[model samples]
Structure formats: structure tokens, C-alpha cells
Target: METIAFFNLKGGVGKTTSAVNIAWHAANEGIPTLLWDLDPQGAASWLLDSKAKSKAQPKKILNGKTPIGNLVKPTNYQHLDIIPADFSIRDLEQQLQLQSEQGQRNLIAKLIEPFSENYALIILDCPPSFSLLSEQIFDTADALYLPLIPTHLSLRTFEQTRDFFKKNKLKPKRLHAFFTMVDRRRSLHRLMLAHPPKMLKNGLPTPIPYAAVVERMGDHQAPLPAFDRNAHVSKAYASLWQDIKATLSDF
Candidate 1:
């Protein structure tokens, strides 16, 4: 299965929202998608209306004490399943740091290997950080999707992330970014959307607009399309999903 992660070092950039929407779109297309909520906050899990059947420690899956498959819970959507995260996931970073470099890198890949036979795609909803867990995600995911807001500070963070990958000798081609929370009323946002930096020229063309509906995801506890498919924000996400599908085809 192809694994993709939605991540950003900076939070509040629509990372989890984008991951949830894309996974829902993939499942709607009958791709048999699995979304693993790796963030300790469990936002994606709650958004999808998925809950752990038992109060099992998520770290058990990491140490092999529990079968990863046992944690998989079907979401309200068809062809979509989720492995919800809880506070226990916060302990994984310390555990990963204790392993050798190779072990740290391969730990996540090994844990998700069994799902390949069932899922065509696995989406990881990652936390906002630069730690050993993030390193494992970088090594395990086939592609990493970054959500950026159209602002000077956001671009600065993007540059820092790019430098991190370069310094670490990670494959830069695996990184793909897109614009989020874009407000055309602001001249800077309009300018960036019209002519992004050369590095971001490769980003997905469709930008998710700043909308109340997008923010209401918590109130709805469902994907945009599920609650208001006709909303412009919902359509934007649909278009973004198409762009992502075409982009992943290359890999």
C-alpha cells in the first residue's frame, strides 16, 4: 500500500483536516483507505466519529505487545477505517529515541506492513513537531503532504523544513505542499496565490479558502463534503483531492 502523511512543524495549518478530507475522498473512490491518527490530540479520530473500542494503550502497538490490526476501527464511512490515537501515543517519541537509527526508521513501516494486504492507501495524521517520531514518519511515508498558509511566516517555516530535509539527505521529491486558509481579500494572500515562490510552484494549484464551514468541522464532526457538499470549501477540497490523486500517480 502507498503511505502518505499530512504534516507540518507549525500547527493550525489544516494538516489534520486535509488528511481527513483526502482519506475520505480516497475511500469514496473505493480505494480502501486507512487513516491512522498519530496525533495525541486525536482530532482526526473525533472528526471521523471513530473511537477506540477499548482503552488500549496505543504504545502497545509500537512495542509489539498488541497487534496493530486489533486497533483498526471502521469509521462511519464505507471503505474507510481508522486507528484512533489517545494520550498514550505521547510516549512513543521517548520509545523511538531509544532505538538505533535504522530501528527508529523502520519501526513505523514494520507496524503498518500487515495492512498493505487490505488497504490500497494509508494516511497518517501527524502531530506538529520535529522529533524522532517525525523522522520515522519521514522514512515510512511514500509521500509527505504539507499544508501551508499563504503568509511570510509560513514560507519561513517551509524553508526551515526544506533545509532540514537537505541537511539530513532525505529525498526532497517526496515533499509536496499546498496552500490553505487563503483569503483573497488580503493583498499578500492574493499575490502569493497568483505567483508563489519558485519552490512552491510545484504545490497543488487548488487553494482551500478561509471559510466558516471549514472551521465548523469540529461542530459537524465529519468531513466538509459529508455535511455540506455544496459549500465552496467542500468543492475546493474535492479539487485538491483530484490534484493529490494525480500527483501520487507519479510515485
Candidate 2:
């Protein structure tokens, strides 16, 4: 199965929203898919209403004498499943630090293997941080999708993230950027759309406009198209997903 980790070091860039929409579209196409809520905030888990329970204190599943599949939970989506996140993941990070120092850990990768057999795609919704957890995520992901806004600050963070990865000698290929929360009324948004910087133009263009319907996704407990197929946001997501499918098939 191909794993796409939707990640960005800076938060509030609609990373989780993009991840949810793309994964939902894949499952709608009858592809067996799973969205891994790797973000400690559990936003993705909350969106999908997954029931996976995590304790406030996470014992290293790798260090523990139990199989990892037990921690997984299925979601309500037909072909889309999810392994929910625990709100207490901040503590999990602290515990992971001890494991990282030992240089003998690959827990998330090992734990995720079972799903590969059944899923056509696995989307990981990661938190906005440059930590060991994020490192492990990059190590396991087959691809990475970065949701970025058309702003100077976002690009700055993107540059730093790239430099950091290069310094660590880990080349995260398949890193693509897409514009989000775009307001065509604004001159800045218009400029970015008309002539996207090299850093933001590595991927296809099917910009998701700033639409209200996307927010209703959570209330409807479904994707944009599933909730309101006629919505502008739904159509935008459809076009983007179509491009992604074409790219994958060619690959």
C-alpha cells in the first residue's frame, strides 16, 4: 500500500483538512484506505468519529510485549478506516524521547504493516512539529503532501524544513505542495495563483477555494462530496483528487 503523510511544520495550514478530503476521495473510489491520526490533537480522529482508545500514558508498544494491531480501531467510513489518536499524545512524545536515544526503535513502521495488506492507501495526519515522532513518520511514508497557504511566513517555514531534512540526510521525495484557504478576492491570493513561486508549483493545480461547506464536513460526519456533492469545495476536491489519481497511475 502507498502511504501518504500529510505534514507541515507550521500548524493551521489546513493540513488535516486536506488529508481528510484526499483520503475520503480515495475510499469513495472503492480503494481500501486508512487515515492514521498521528497528530496528538486527534482532529482527524474526531472528524471521522473513530473509536480507537489511547491511554494518557503510552507505553512503548515496541517495548511492550504485545502486538501493535491491537491498538488499531476501525472508523465508520465504508472503505475508509482510521486508527484514532489520543489527546494525551503530548505525553507519548516524552516517552518516545527515551526510546529515540537508544537508536533501536521503529515502532510506528512495524505497527502499521498489517494494514498495508488490506489498504490501497494509508494517509497519516501528522502534527505540526519537527520532532522524533515526525522523523519516524517521514521514515515510513512513501509520499508526503504539504498543504501550504500563499504567505511569506509559510514559505519561510517550508525552507527551514527542507534545510533541516537535507541536513539530516533524509530525502523526502514525493513532497508536493498545494494551495489552500484561497480567497480569490484578495490580491495576494490572486498573485499566488497567477504566478506561483517555484517552491509552491511542484504539484498540479486544482485550488480549493475558501468555502464554507468544508467546515460542514465535520457536522455531517462525511467528506465534502459525500455531504454536498454540488458544493464548490466538493467539486474542487474532486478535481484535485482526479489529478492525483492520474499521477499515481502513471507512477
**Which has the greatest TM-score?**
1
Deviation from truth (RMSD, Å), model 2: 2.4
What residue runs in model 1 are displaced by over 4 Å at the alpha carbon? Answer: 101-105
**Model 2 global lDDT (CA atoms, 0 to 1):** 0.76
Candidate models: Cα lDDT each: 0.86, 0.76
lDDT of 2 by residue, 223-248 (tens): 67666889888788888888666546
Q: Please give, for residues 1-251, the per-residue lDDT of candidate 1 as tens digits.
A: 79999989999899999999999899998999999999988999999988876767667767788888888999989999998885365577666766554544467788889998899899999999988778888888888889999998998888887778888888877788899999999999999998899887557889999998887888989998898999998999999989888778632
TM-score of 1: 0.95
Clashes of 1: 0
State TM-scores per candidate: 0.95, 0.89
TM-score of model 2 vs. true structure: 0.89
